[model samples]
Target: MQIVTEKLLNLGVDEDKEINESQLVLLDVKEDEKSEWKALSLNKQLSDARAELFVLLNGVEDKEIQDKIIFNYKALQKFRKKENDKELIVEKEVQIQTHERGDVTIYCDGGCTPNPGKAGSGIAVYRNDKLSELWYGLYEEMGTNNTAELGALYESLLLAKKESENGNTVEIKCDSMYSINCIKTWAISWEKKGWTKKGGEIKNLEIIKLSYHLYNSIKKDITLSHIKAHAGFEGNELADRMTMYTIQEKSESFVKYDKEIIVVDILKMRA
Candidate 1:
């Protein structure tokens, strides 16, 4: 998904050297100041780019690479447009309070059917290894698995903060390594870089930033771990099941799962 920018075409621009060669360039100035090279409205430009790329390659043969390229290109467009300004004003903030002397574990998951449709997130919370609460929702008509995963993780962080305030040490388990890395690993560097990445635009930056903020605020009492999905981890399996419940029921808000949890029955519910 490499693009040709003005710096690549021009002779001298030391600063442009830092830009990745494979970066997606939405627009660049033409030879004259008043003219532009490939300017179009963001959506129209992106549609054309995707069409041209797929045509060049003959078809969408490699889905992973195709998804990555399109995801980063769209992210770059959002970055350029400063589209998340209103979204950055998050209403929720972590508050520090005295602890209550308990321990809790939270398992969270998210998924989408058909890759880009009917996405939702789910969470299973346990107190001292005993099932205590279940949560699911954040439904989207058209959303990626990554967004759903991040949404679940963000909600888990909120619950973890609450548990931490209750004097409990909290552990959060998630199967998506990408989401975990975005919050616990890469976010530190991304924050320092003003939320821009040298490799490309940061995908899901808004939620990642919010999750990172909440995680850091309560990190002293909370631990985040990555686990294998559908590998006989009961909590993870339960959380995974929760994701489907919302999509099945067409729920949009992040709400509690009030039904009783018979492990085998709940597992079979999804089957």
Candidate 2:
């Protein structure tokens, strides 16, 4: 029977007794016989896999291969739900409530023109309501917006992971939901697929890989979220500003300090 390509890949099929998406499931199959499984219609195949996908057809369909997957449909739905979950509103240099616990916040962003052309990145941190530190770099040549964004995020998180002398928990934030999702869920597959979606020319492979490594460096669970762009959000606005700062070579605005405390605002997006 046909299975969703993603589902097949995710289930690690063929590892041992692995077969299909539904193979590892404990679902009480309506049928137990292999013949019954073979005779099942296609929808049941997805259902068996416990896929969160939905029907996308113009008419009531029948064939197993009639529908196309809405890539990232589940991720977007989950993202929207998270956005509505009491708004993890991360603000700028707003003294974190975690100072007593000694945890700091990090923000990162990046950009480039003609994508594979000139690139730039920025990283900032806040502690106890002040700009504890900032990092900005320029890519006179090479890379794209997505690459630069991943670069900025990776370097920033690296800084946070390194600064934790006591092995304190740190939080890193960014506005690119795709970046967050890819790092959290798709990094391995992307790596195995050569950083390309289907083993093609992965535009941002290097930086994406770097970001993945940085994410894994955290001793505690990582948290990432999307911040509204151009909605007068301070943390996001600064992240954008920091990114443009590198591209424009205006490196004077960034700061550096020790000791910080504030809710992490993961703000960064490219226009």
Candidate 3:
């Protein structure tokens, strides 16, 4: 508990203030009566509580602290379920046509406003000459720019895997050399070394592993290319805009995909 508290302090959170505030909000929730719990108000409370929980969850490395955080998270999840609130849930899987023709290109970007502050990730997918999908979401807690960038790459590959058939080429464009090299080169050595580099623990190991697996799972010609960020590339520019929009507005999980035309909705993740 002390370690987790210190970690939260290092992340610029006032422990007493934040926890007290969250407790007050949780206490206000009417657990028995659904009629008194307005959707909007309950959502705001859940979001705030989740945000605090994420900060604590992300900051700590100890399993004990993680278990404590998960306990709190489960309580929040239970309350949210009782209220039938689905706004904060995110879809973990998506289905798309596997035989779509032509090449698919994905542009991805991610960053935090203050680099180590609230972070977000965005991706834009183009099939042949038409835009196919757009996705962006805010990180629940504070995170580094690289974490968000790696998340973008991971999500892009995940989408490509779901949307493309075998033998179809998929191109991923991003500006982060660190993220690009991690999957393309560094990850191999890291895995051989038990997920380490220079005998030191690797940062963003979870996302890096996820990205590596997703990259390898695609049985197609997958190309990762670096583009000059903030330059005039159309897809890159839109991805950047979407990333910034998420960070600035703290956008919820949003996904828009082309089905005949573009369709978007707030989705929930399946357990």
Alpha-carbon TM-score of each model against the true structure: 0.63, 0.49, 0.62
Q: Name the regions of candidate 3 deviating beyond 4 angstroms.
A: 1-95, 98-100, 249-254, 257-271
- Which ranking of candidates, highest TM-score first? 1, 3, 2
> Model 3 residue 215 lDDT?
85
Error of 1 at 212 (Å): 0.9
By lDDT, the candidates rank as 1, 3, 2
Looking at candidate 3, the ten consecutive residues that score lowest on lDDT are 262-271
Write the residue-wise lDDT of candidate 2 on 133-226 in tens digits: 5566645466677766777677666566554543445667677776777688888787776566864566566667777877776735445555
Q: Clash totals for all models, in order?
A: 4, 9, 0
lDDT for each residue of candidate 1 in 12-106, tens digit (9 for 90 to 100): 22333321212223233333432333242122323345434433332334557656766776778668545443332231222223323477899
Best candidate (score: TM-score) = 1
Report the Cα lDDT for candidate 3. Answer: 0.65
What value does the lDDT take at residue 34 in candidate 2? Answer: 34
Evaluated at residue 96, the lDDT of candidate 1 is 22
Compose the digit string of candidate 3's lDDT tens values, residues 1-271.
1222334333433433332233323324444543333332332423445446645553354667667766878898788664542432223342345346678888998877686888888887788957766677745468888988998888788766755554457888999999999887999998898787885688888889988877877735577889888676667766765676577557545444322322221111100
